[model samples]
Target: MATRRIISTEKTILDKDDDDISSPVAGQQQSSNTAPAVPMDVILKLLAFTFAMVVVPIGSYFLSVNTFFKGNSTYAGGLAAVMANVVLVGYVIVAMNEDQSDQLEAKKKAGKKE
Candidate 1:
């Protein structure tokens, strides 16, 4: 009987391109606490996204709706697309509001702690 050994040629490489401020790495001093900045960044990103999605479609809808599509149900695809955009913006704003409330709750908890 002969015993055979199996070897993996794949090398396990850990990428350090991602910087986690919470994890203190040896030989390097991490600067001030960056936790507060994260929520603000997320909020700003959402706000920008919300405005882009809402404003662009609205501007184009008005610009083309008058000259292009005459009736609402005349073309199924055109009407469906308009309705879809309206529903999408509605859901996005709901999500944005939820995130805002969650951030407020986090701030309240932090305030209670201090």
Candidate 2:
């Protein structure tokens, strides 16, 4: 004897009515916004500043290293490196400011949608 198979298709309670389903609510805007883009001019300026800090003092230290002991020479090189790092930090600050401005602009645009 051969057995027969049956297939059933039924809608669940959740699928009964489209109108009864709730949509997701929109998210709230946060106070701290993203920054805007940095201009090419500003980027070039920062790069120049960084290069100046890193190259000039270090070169000067190298030129004068013969006049000082190894310890003093190392100290001067370290100071130059720290100054270069400070310039790099300035770049970071500028980037962060740009991001904040961008976020605020985005929030303003989103507010308009509401």
Candidate 3:
């Protein structure tokens, strides 16, 4: 019977001993457990837009299929596509507004510091 030995040269976290283990790597500073780079409001806004993107298209498709289009699947599909684009445009507009507001706030803070 022959035995095969597998050798790994890489030093993974699991392979490190207690003495060799360290939190921060060389020349890297450890950050404090403070607020994230993205604000909660920004996260929520993105999530809401994402949810709308998913739900709006499907809901419009089903609602228009029988209600407005009179079982015309082609028109219903078109409306669904249009609704998706509308949602995308809405998200873009909201993002642009938020970006502009953030820039304004940054300028205000800078002015205060000076």
Candidate 4:
């Protein structure tokens, strides 16, 4: 009786290809080439600028009214001024929160790499 040996060239080549696919070399270059995108801080700055632009006009209106009336008025003008300032404050808060969230997201992404 004679003993025969079986060899698989296809299986060996497939195993080699799989090893190369799983290696870190292929993914490293791709990840390095493409970085994550981040929104510009200029957008937040523009929002704050817009808020200031709006607030200034409203404030000037209140100041003019106060000066014209010698600081005397019914509750309406005062309420309006307060409301305008409150709106300005809200815009500021929103801008700040957006900036903070962006920073946090960037930090989280950085942490993921480590």
Candidate 5:
């Protein structure tokens, strides 16, 4: 009996381009080339609401379970669920208001242009 060895060449070769990989320190104007998809204020609001969504539920669960619910997990869980829904509704309301403001600003700009 004879043993045979097998070789595989499945690796892919990638072409490197100068524009694809750039050092930010090397160019000062690189950041100004493209605007962010989401505005900074919008991103900040999203982050704040996301944090509230997490903290509000857990905090309410713990606090209410001991203080208000008298260690009744059922009531605590229910309160947590309600708090989560409240946070969700609040986020939606805030987003709607922000969108309305943006539309109003656009309308104002259009009016000025005309």
Candidate 6:
């Protein structure tokens, strides 16, 4: 047990030395350089999602239930909620697919490099 512990400690030290010798990897460290700008599409998606989930549902409830369409407010509110949920789910699915593709591409590039 003592020998195993010593070997493990030595291995960790060696790994630390290796990491220190290497230059910083991408995304692990941020330098003084300005960060890359986020794509417009992502910004738009976030804004749209916020509006759908936060604004539309509450606004729909207040407007339909209290102001304009009191008799049909229940239906309007329900529809608004459903639509927001649908948009959220759709956005999640799309984002997941994009991430998966990016990961797969990274793996392919890594494999080629190896």
Which residue runs does candidate 3 get wrong by more than 4 Å? 1-33
The whole-model lDDT of each prediction reads 0.66, 0.71, 0.91, 0.70, 0.87, 0.76
Lowest summed lDDT across 10 adjacent residues in model 2 is found at 19-28
- Candidate no. 6 TM-score: 0.50
Score every model by TM-score: 0.36, 0.44, 0.71, 0.39, 0.70, 0.50
Pairs of colliding residues, candidate 4 = none
The pairs that clash in candidate 6 are: none
Two-way TM-score contest, 2 vs 3, winner: 3
2 or 4: which has the higher TM-score?
2
Query: Which candidate would rank higher by TM-score, 1 or 4?
Result: 4
In lDDT terms, how accurate is model 6? 0.76
Give the C-alpha miss distance for residue 50 in model 3, angstroms.
0.9
Candidate 6 lDDT over residue span 2-114, tens digit each? 55446644658768889776767764864566766887777887788877778766776766765566668678778678767877897798789878988999999999999
| Candidate 1: tens digits of C-alpha lDDT, residues 17-91 | 334534677878767775675567668766876776667665656655656676443454465467558767776
Ranking by lDDT: 3, 5, 6, 2, 4, 1
- Model 2 lDDT per residue over 1-114, tens place: 999554355655556565344433365443555675867767787788777777777776775566554557777777667766776787778778978988999999999999
Better by lDDT, candidate 3 or 2: 3
RMSD of each: 13.4, 10.9, 6.7, 15.7, 8.6, 8.1
1-114: candidate 3 lDDT, tens digit per residue = 999565687555566764354656776887778779999999999999999999999999999899998999999999999999999999999999999999999999999999
Model 5 clashing residue pairs (backbone)? none
